[model samples]
Target: MRPLASLFKGWFLIRRDLSSSRRLFLTAVSFVLPLALWCLVSYVDWIWHPDIKLQLSSEREGNSTVFTAGDHISPGYYQEMVVATRAENTRLLASTPPPKSSKRANQKLLRQLAPVAISHDWLPYTEAQNDASIYHLWRDIATGTKIPTDPALTPENLDIVKQNWAQLAPLAADFSLASLPETPLLKLIPQGLPANPVYLPAPHEVWRSGWRDFKAVPPEGELSMTQRYQHSLRVILLGFFWACVVGVPIGILCGVFDFFSKLFEPFVDFFRYMPAPTFSTLLVAVLLAGDAPKIALVFIGTVFQMILVVSKTTRLLDPSLLEAAQTLGASPKQMLTRVVIPGILPNLYNDLRILLGWAWTWLVIAELIGVKSGLTEFIETQGRFRNFDRVFPVIILIGVTGFVTDQILSWLHGIIFPWTGRGNPIAQTFFRILFWPFRQISKLSDRAGTPT
Candidate 1:
């Protein structure tokens, strides 16, 4: 009970201190405004482009049917085929007797499940490739062979497979018996299809797509969001730890000693101006691949900036406190320990918290350099595959993670430096509000322990 009370008291104090800042409301609004904009852009489809349309026609000549379907934009053909296949599947499913044992049913299904037509256009390229991959997987399953690993399949499609595995298994078995060639089919449906097809998905569709990927297992050879997030956290923390070790001491030295400050200030300032990413080639060459280069990239990014900030903070320390300590017969080391360190510790903590947010910015670029196994990599891969759903969520994840981390560090700063924002009336009010519930709890506990 005492420990719980202590914890509550700590939480209460932190909350009270943070509430002192009227900027918090503005900060919250800043976050909400972007989300509102995102919602607006997504719901309105203000930038949506019209999908390419493909026309397919069949003509009978000399008792032979000639089927033709092609479009100037190749994805148009692939998109039409996908829609047609889905429609054909629905029609077959809706038919009587289920077409379970019919030879014609098997042939038609196989024909509909033919290899996707390749398109030179970039728009349909990935979709066509994905459909082709799915077809191959379906063919393999139908033939009673193991499904080949496909890293390109989005999590949503993967989830669909997992959910309908039982139904698909039998379908695959039925499909295997059909002696169909692996040729591309020219079956096309009507144009001006509803705007809600898989290709031209609305903003909600994009969100749903991303949500599925967020909840689903990543395809073969790709890291899940959880895995990527953990990797990113590890990389950022490792780099931050090393940066502190190197930067903080140097920063302290620069702050306290004029000679040290003169020697290091120019170099730190100059290097910080140069972007950390430009050094990627050198870092990669020297450190080689794997975690070393990535970690080095993060370290390079934060360390120089941290050094300058820490030095500035240390330089800002009150000279009167240092003079008082010296006049009290304290040695140089003693003056630093008693006055300089203590004087700047709170401000330093706040500086480090702000710098930590900057560290996450470097993290995405760092992860891109070597291993390709973090949230940034996931976003890049999904973006290449045009899985904007997966990409958008990971991007949002980065922002949310950084925001939450910053808030948590803010709370910690308040706890560590109780004097921070002490005189504000808003803080006083917040303190009272936070204490009320705990006070009531303590009173109830005391009453229960006494008479009952």
Candidate 2:
């Protein structure tokens, strides 16, 4: 009778310690308000800002020629610099006074190639110069027109040639240098140069075509707001799915045994300190050799933070829970299935919620890694070109997406594991308005269920 009485009291105490309702509600609402505000702001902006248009809409259908040569300008400028240098070398070789041996010939050839004075209008020249200097080949690639090589091109010269070859290889179909009819410099040039594609803001130009509301228009194609929303959601879902696939089993192992924890502890700690973008680079070098840098960035950043949350939460599970299960004649598998997992499930869900929030931060870093798509990519691309208006909307989109994701995770946690939440006093103040309605419902339910 005494032992039975003690068991009941112990169960009651544990239940008391574990029982949490208001705390969970408060925690949930605390995370939800910011997301709501963000969504509201985004929707309002979409309603009011009707001037902006997605880049893809400006193109005439089937007019692929409109794709600017400026897209290839970075490498093109480098090639021009190399060509200019080679020309200088040819000029030096043809001069009346010739130099001695092949090696001396090369050295003399190089000496004869002096730096050309560039005009202020030569932006391409400047860009190439900057690129070559950083790569330690400005003198070789940019000044090489002054020399001739009987023995062969120097390694420095070879490197420049290699870089130029690599750059041209992908666009071999598009390379051309055609003669044009002479005319006035300004008027002789085609107004819409395919290569330059400089912006010409004519007052009569259509502000937006087809779509009156810029926000509703897809950035490209037959894109709509619904499509953009779907794409964004898919990215988040894919990211979260992979995170769980990588994080859960390891988390279970860490919780179930002490040895596994020790083995992975240092690795987890080291990775936690490392920035999420590092994982993107490391993964790119290993698994997906062909992965676009942007994809690698997303995968690395998502998994890195997810792994930390899962392992840390598992590491913190109560040791006593396992001991008690063992005392009850539970088999190891049974202990894990019934006691260990349920004990850690709440913390796991909470970690997942926090991890989703971290995913947004990683999203920007991922998009910056050579991706030409997504809100983060758009924001970065615009920001680099100093298009503040375009950049701002993309930033707002990212924030709204992050906020919505956070809210969803919170709502899921509330519905799935109501018993898991314990209160932090800090959440109470922030969630007062959010909590009041729920509190009233709880009171009404209690009164309805009570007997007269």
Candidate 3:
């Protein structure tokens, strides 16, 4: 109790800095707690799993929706699928078997058991679609040699495997396309575990899906993930660059001069109230599609706010420094350039860091307008198709990109303004390494000059 109390002491002091270790610990917990909550709802049974996640699935004759392993369905819909598939099998047995299916089609149907066999380590994943290995796996399950326990088959499915094998074994002991029976085999019953809805995929499922997507080859003419990442970076940086160029000097002038303030502030304040998106269609019409319109939207969204923020920051600089500079006989331009800009720079840097995040907030909306482009384009496409697992990676990537970029900028801020004494320990160490060669050269020069 004493150790724990000591560990957390001073944690609640207003505006006080926590120790480096404590800050890092809190940062880790911030990320971990959300993941833990996600896991709690995802992996725990009897805990609000409102749908069924299929492990074994089959096609219905008339239905175009072909469910595969990992597909999510409502419990009520799952029941309907079972009833429908079972009725089809009953009809298949009662009526004459339909015309012999192509060997290719039969091989694909046999691969339905591949998920089951792979889970129990009976089938190698690389050979999941291989016919001969899956045929032996079915025989082993039917003859009671290999038992599937982790994801054991439904009792009804076990019966179907035995029935299907009875039909297959007589034609050929091993898998052979030519030796396959003309009559179709019994399809396995659809079975699943209770799960959360499709939108909330399990962590491992997200990881696997994300990994597969990142490594996947895009179809010809589609942008790869790296290209998408670069494009997003380009959009934000370009937008922010133009905003800085046009807005910052005007903002500084507004802060310094009453004439500029009265002339611009009223109109700027009025225009800022109008949401930037309202002008998106107008921008598209004038800019006429492609990247130009998209970049224009981001500029319109960020520039007004940036001007207001920078002007406010500029006005907040201490007045005593300007008084001292005037007493020292500084000229008007000298005071403006040398006093005001330098005094406000640190806070101004902090303000821009925050404003860059605002620029990112506009990225998704900006990308969706005119021509869809960047990572947001991929997210929009995947989300529209209800592939939330694919969408999750892109969303997470954007968040991580923004967060990491801010952290790096913050670290550089501390190193740049060492007198401010504000930066993480890692940044401080990196600052030291950056000047290490110069320090070493100075030490050598001092030694050579000393009497020896």
Candidate 4:
């Protein structure tokens, strides 16, 4: 009981550091909470699913728009489709002499079964547009040779398949576009499972779409996912690198002496507030279109703020280090180099890490400012089409790229500055292994140099 109480007390201690287990638990909970809420809103039936995602759909006469599988519509709209389609179907069957339709039209009608067949694992998605395979699938499903489950065919949809197959089979045993029936075939009803609004797709949908998109081969003359990712990384890293190159020395000078500070910090402070993005049109006008303007925007956006933040971090260094250096007869150059720079390096690294993240916020805007390249362009195009499932992956990829890079930098920080007591265990272990021979040789030399 006492041990348990101590463990619990460690958890609730006010203004104190949490135990490592609690730290990991809270970190995990940070992600889990949002996902759990999303799952509740998505998977829990009768909660907030305001739309039905059509697993099967059809084309009506004289309408060029075709709603196929995976389309979303409001419940009211779905019901309207059902009523109108049923009415149109009745008119077709009751018409005297059973109104003839084009073989192409009936051929397309038979293909609506593709979604149902795919859902039941009776067909592969890549084979979807294969009319010959779709023809055979219709026969298999109608005769019950293929059983549908998970989303087993509703009795109504099953009946439509049987009836449509009856008309289709009479024309040809297998798929022959020319051999397709001239008679009208029954349209599959607009059937769907319950779904949330398209903007908030299910987690499975996001994962599946992400996988498919990443694995797919892009069209020729277009960029692949890797290429887009490389372009985005190039923009961010180049921007941050240029900012550091131009800003770090100025910031360090300002921190070390009042002369530089009075000359530079005042102007930097004033200019940072003017907004980096406001320069986009001017940049495009001067720099012209391409990666030049995009990279320049990131540099302009991040550099001013980087200078200010790094200057502040420099000033926060312990004055006692300066006092100690002065007492040792260190000159002004030695004081700046030996005392100030080394002392501020750790904090400056952290400051730059944060500023790197700040630079990423401008990525979408930066890409748009020029020729519209990188992941942002892809996101905008998909967003316009309202394919939210496809959109989530690109957004998630950007987030993940930043997160993993930060974590790697963080782990390396600890390894690179072990005296600061902030290195990763894995990094420390690797460092020890890699330097073992040198460390052993140094020990042997030290022992030989000592007098007995």
Candidate 5:
């Protein structure tokens, strides 16, 4: 109880000391309010823009029937179609097996049994049925089920079905069925419900689906999310390392030597304008695929930009500082090593941190060029499969990882340049908040030990 009281007291003291407490509060609210709004919008079925309730109609014209989107189909039309199909099937079964020469006639009769209006686009009923069939077929394939086909299905139709089946097979093999909702709320809504025909999934459902995908291991030799993240991190770090090695030295030379700056500045500036992804084919041709091309892609993306930034940072050094070092009998090498490097170290750290984030932005493009074994690959593949649940989570994961990485770098920067944080009000407030409870405990101990 005493510790808890002290903790609250410390929080109050820290809060009082931080003059920007209101700002901090607002910042927190800024994050929370959007999330709250997202949850609200997702959970509640608010009718913003209602779906256009299409009224489809069909009229007989000569030998064919014309259907229009504005026309309405009577319930009896569905019943008549069902009866006709059943009667035709019965007659086909009752008669002697058709000769091989009558195969075309059988196909024609099958088409008649499945008579669809020429203007199906205008027929809501036909469109809905078609959509539902396609949806179910996709669902079945996604769940690793082989679709059942009629034995008497024509060769042309069978070929078309086979082509679709082949295309969806990879998705089925890769898809994690556990991601789907066991009791989907969307199923409760009627197919032709007012306002919207499509289901707007709840936030919880999306989160659950994402979670499932995060934990799922793809079949075959494909990498999981964890493995992919590691690979991505490795590629980013390697590319960053190489970029720093080359760019920093060149930047320093450009900053220190007027001649070098004049010579290289134009070339670097020109290349910077050309996007890195455009070099993908060239990189592939030179590096010949594999991790080399991917790494080269990341390197190309970051290097030119890093060089320019570093050079500008170096050039911004105070002239007085350089003069003072020179006056103190400091050698050129010693001045660079001791004075210049230390002075720019803090800003350089900040620049590197910012550039590291930029490097992550290039990761997807890099991974796409040659190797597809990162978070980008998961996102791209799942996105193509229309697994928004999986895609959203991977995106969120990337954001969270970047945020954590930035924070870690910020902590490192403070450790390396302790003086920088001393003047920063935000940092001061943060440290006070961090150590307030310990300070409170110390105060209590001091009071108890005093001769009272």
Candidate 6:
């Protein structure tokens, strides 16, 4: 009891310490909230599937098999078998033959094997069955070898049992099924049966071999993963570059003078209220209307919002600081370069961080329209073909990339403007809330505005 009490006390102390730690807790909560909401919505059978789906892909011979975890599997050219229960009514209407049944004595066994049976209206194997023999063939496909009363059913004897199974001839020819048929099941085979069904393994049971060289192959072209990533990097870099170029100048110009702010205020307000694509459309019409325009439509969409952020931050600069520098006989260029730029810089960098996120969002929108390259384009490509397996990885990659970039930017901001740390609302609010109890306790130690 004493040890447990001590452990509880230690845990409480650790909790208090974490509560007093810093802004990271708040940021963590902010990050976790979205994921929690996503999970909740997904679990609730909302329009969107939660991120719980896992794609199991396997290659056999020249074909591929994909199994989707959870519900809502896609209909593809590939074969599928669903293991589900048939109600009592369904059993009567289906009139499934006992000889044709794969069911064992157990009710659970019956349910398990029901999915592979054939009725007048239902055939559950990978292919359609025109006869009872076909269903019997599927029944012969034992996932496990049966134990015999006479023999121990050793692996060595199992080989002999497998050799006697004639319904498994195709599999024997192709080296798939190895279980023996003891009931003379192959006697039910029709005289002129088509080639035996290709015994395909389940998605988890596929294997691959080394590639072979094919001479004089026809051209089959598609972008590789590396190529796709290269394209994405280029688009991201270009967006960043344009954002810096456009955002910096606008920020600097508005920070320097009151006149420009007055002139740009209404325009900025109008543009800010207007959708980003509206500016994009106008810009596209003016700058990109020409044949073979150098800048893509995506660049225009991504940069406009950044420009507004830069302009807003610039307009928010402290006028008193500028006046002070001017009063000190600092020349116009010197004041502009020395005072205004440095004063507005912390905010400028913060604006850049926010704009970078916006730029990524716009990149997606841009790719939805005219952008030819980037992660957004990759998503669009996947959506076009309904290849959601490929799509999900790209989505996760974009999120990770954005998150990593934001962290890098935050680190760079810390290095560049150490003094501005105290004033950051996110950081200050985070730390203040974290240490609130400590502050309260410290206040109790003070008497009449004096520290004890």
Q: For each candidate in turn, give its C-alpha RMSD to the true structure in angstroms.
A: 13.9, 21.6, 6.1, 4.3, 15.1, 16.3
- Measured against the true structure, the TM-scores of the candidates, in listed sequence, are 0.61, 0.44, 0.77, 0.84, 0.60, 0.51
Supply the TM-score for candidate 4: 0.84
TM-score of 6: 0.51
Q: In terms of lDDT, which candidate is stronger, 2 or 6?
A: 2
Show model 1 residue runs off by greater than 4 Å.
1-32, 45-173, 181-207, 218-222, 422-452
lDDT of 3 by residue, 1-452 (tens): 99988976788889899899989999999999999989987899788899898889988777898888767899999999899889978987888636566666666778889988866556643467878899888899999898887579888989999998888888889888898776777788898889987468778766755776677677678888888889888888898889889888988998888888889888999998998888889988998888777777778888888788888888898888899999999999999999999888898888889988988888778888888898888888878766676788888888898899898888788887877877667877887999999999999999999998
lDDT of 4 by residue, 235-330 (tens): 888988889999999889888788888999999999999888898999899999988888888999888898888888889999888998899999
Worst 10 residues of 3 by lDDT: 118-127
Report the C-alpha lDDT of model 6 over 8-32, residue by residue, as the tens digit: 4543344455433344766788989
The clash numbers for all candidates, in the given order, read: 1, 10, 0, 2, 6, 1
**Model 5: ten consecutive residues of lowest lDDT:** 184-193
Sort by TM-score, best first: 4, 3, 1, 5, 6, 2
lDDT accuracy of residue 218 in candidate 6: 20
Off by over 4 Å in 6: 1-220, 278-298, 371-373, 381-389, 421-452
Worst 10 residues of 4 by lDDT: 118-127
Q: Please, what are the lDDT tens digits per residue for candidate 1 over residues 197-224?
A: 2333334645655565565576687666
Winning candidate number (TM-score): 4
Clashing pairs in 5: 51-195, 55-70, 56-71, 56-72, 57-71, 69-122
The models' CA-based lDDT, in order, is 0.63, 0.48, 0.83, 0.84, 0.61, 0.47
**Model 5 regions lying over 4 Å from their true place:** 1-18, 47-201, 423-452
